[model samples]
Target: MGVADQINWVDAACWNGTAFDGGWNTRLATNQDVLEPATGQALWRVGVASAADMTAAIERAHAAQVAWAATPPRERAAVMLKAAALFEQHFDELALMIARETGGIIPKGHHEVRESVVLCQLAAAMPMQSQGQVLPSTPGRLSIARRVPHGVVGVISPFNFPLILSLRSVAPALALGNAVVLKPDVRTPASGGFILARVFQEAGLPAGVLQVLPGNAEAGEALVTDPRVPMIAFTGSPGVGRRIGELAGRHLKKVSLELGGANNLIILEDADLDAAASAAAFGAWFHQGQVCMASNRVLVHASVVEGLKARLVGKATHLPVGDGASGQVALGPMIDAKQLARFDALVQETVQQGATLEAGGTFEGLCYKPTVLSGVKPGMRSFDDEPFGPLVNLVTFDTDEEAVSLANNSQGGLSSAVISRDVGRAMAIGEQLNAGMVHINDQTVNDDCTNPFGGPGLGGNGSSVGGPADIDEYTRWKWITVKASVPQFPF
Candidate 1:
């Protein structure tokens, strides 16, 4: 059946051009069916926007950027403040919708919704707090640098953490006075894209100020290639991010990408075994281990490896898994069948080689049990490669240097964690690991609004998308000079 024929689609389908159903059924000729990963139910479908539709959307965003940029920063901040409240007011509805669309458990879905409110509030306050500086100049002349928005910004958000991930960038871009064209993941158009559109549009934001295009890669590519969009913000795999970065660089357009990471967690001899195990469990298994900054490998001291394994495996064995939308499971199903197959294949192949399948690592339907593997070595794929699933490989080290080497061995450096009895020692070890965000006694998946969230190497390029620093990413500095008298020049 065509997506237009689906009944639930009327409630969940993402908006097209700010209109309900947004004339997509008539203009868009192609459609992609969205499946509920846990239940295999046909939830809704997304339209593959034609080139004409994409062009029209970009043009509208471009036109809106002019007046929106001219509006005072305080007024823009007010709009964002209201948007934050809207998100809070509709938190329950959005959370349940997110759980259905993205397969996130109720608690995680709630976190996504609640945190988004804070993200918007924090971003709203940034324009007022962040200001340009004055530079020293000659007498009777004043030199100043002022920040200005880069006009229209195209945001390509991912499916995982749909609400927080998309809004984290959108809220900041809008707060900094840039009109945003959000291209949410096709897999999660309703909760990820359209809900945000509704919140902002209803909050009294002018028409065309925020547009949502719920399509696939074609839409994202069009947004990037369009001259109307001066900035591109994306969150996804590193390979895609690299290509986008190269293209944006060629076009002289501003871009920021929060890409993939194969992070690590180090457990010292003095570390508490139970505490370390709990942190590891939450980091590697939460959200089905889809977090980009999750630890792909755990480096533990040889003296305490056995004890930590006992505790971790026990937790993994008893945890329930499946049906995130309606059931209270410890870990939800994988995003889709393809993701499950990829994750299963990696674990199977690693076990076939030399690794021991300790506790879980089996799949039933689209859901997979939390898996633990030991005896993973350097050559094995599970050692360094990030599966972005509920899997963790354990490797032991004798000294702190070996631990540090194991941690920094990955090509990507998004985040890492150090667990130890000594805070001073943990801080010392954290300094040595090559990661963008390092946790002293916690897990690798850290997303604090106040901290700048990004990484080095394969992780990302350019500026980050969080904290007040984001003002610098969505806007550029321009120098203005005023003189009481004409400056004397040697002519």
Candidate 2:
């Protein structure tokens, strides 16, 4: 049965003063389903919470966080470890739910679930590494730098890769002793927020340390603007990220915004064409290219442009496209109809601008066939904006200088990749790119659970939210000094 024909709509889950209570329910779209994009199919059935309820939840979280933070880091680590184990135990179940809710292919869903487990494990080990430093100071005096939690953190998560991204933000916040009142994307709340809440509860988290409030932007806005919420960690579009920054700015709250990207992938003449082609295919198509770090633009050397395009097209064509639940499916439907429309509009715009459609430009229902376009220029929407779908734009450059120029043309500096047989040269180019993270001879989506992952500039606000360094994002540095003798007071 089609998604439109399946399920009843109801409040999937909500905060009830102390804990998340309710079950998942399907509801009709609040707007005309036809006018709404495929990605927006999941309607907002959960009753919207009043600002007072949100304020109360934040207050409760603050109260719980005082005691929760007082609990030793080791104890918090234990709970995180248990949650990781629980994540592993429920991997298949979580993967299935993720696939259904977000339209992630089965394999990709499984990969994200496994990665989520690893992220929790990494978060669990964070306390051991979150040590303070002693600074050299004047004789008979000591200076110490310590990390402190920000009391209550409001996490506003996006819909794409819902479970993984939400956990990526939440696990670190909880591990660092901050209470979290998460506002998950309205579309895929059950798969991530609801599931993780169960995991945390089972892992013995304090009653109010982790709360899930699933609703629309109003819900998230309420959380971020609330004075009790000291920090806001958000992952979504640059437009939304800007709004979040503005709100957080007005309140003088700490903010971490992981926004959109029109990432570039450069293929040098000396690069192993096969390796570059494979990486490009995976980077472009993974999770239907919904990832913030996905390579949206491809800049290949003119010397090997034909070869790279041939191999990439062949690989993209063989990818299995079907329902996310079928298990054999490699590419699933766009997250919802809204996303499909956006993808369609972008591709149409590209065609109108005179780009060549190399393969897979048509859509069947909500399924956008993996597409590749050649002869793309920097000024086109596909090159300047994020498509957030399984579409790849290929442009050719004659030299490394030209490639760097082309790659840096986009306003986004989230991530980039340089493929070349000359590792040193690729590394040099990678460093020169303005992206937050760059890969040599590989794709930008390759991330380590224990390594810092975030973009620079518009891609991110120079904050690292993953890896061992992630604890720093959840913490604030406080310096303390002790003197051997108190100085005489002067009136």
Best by TM-score: 1
What lDDT does the true structure give each of the candidates?
Answer: 0.81, 0.78
lDDT of 2 at 246: 93
Predicted candidate 1 versus true structure: per-residue lDDT over 1-491, tens digit per residue? 42233323235444432322222233453667778787787766566565566677888778888898888878888988998998788777777778878888988889998898898899889778746888999888899998888888989888888888889888888887888888888788776787787788767778887877776667777888888888999999888888888888888888898887678899999998999999999988989998888777888999999999999899999999988866568888888887789889999999988999998888898789999999887878888577789987899999988988887787767889999989998999899988888898998888877788888876787357788568778888999999887867999
Q: Which candidate is the best by lDDT?
A: 1
Residue-level lDDT of model 2, residues 1-491, one tens digit each, is 53333323212233222226222222212321111123434432343445555676687788799998889889999999998998888777677667777777777778878998898888888776736799988888899999988889898888887777889988988888899988777667666577788788888998888877666776677898988888999989888988999999999999998886768899888888888888888888887888898888989999899999999889778887767667776787887767789888999899899999888988777778889999999788898889899988999999889988888887756789888778999988888898888887788787776777778777977777787567678988999999988978996
Model 2 residue 94 distance off true place after TM-score fit, in angstroms: 1.0
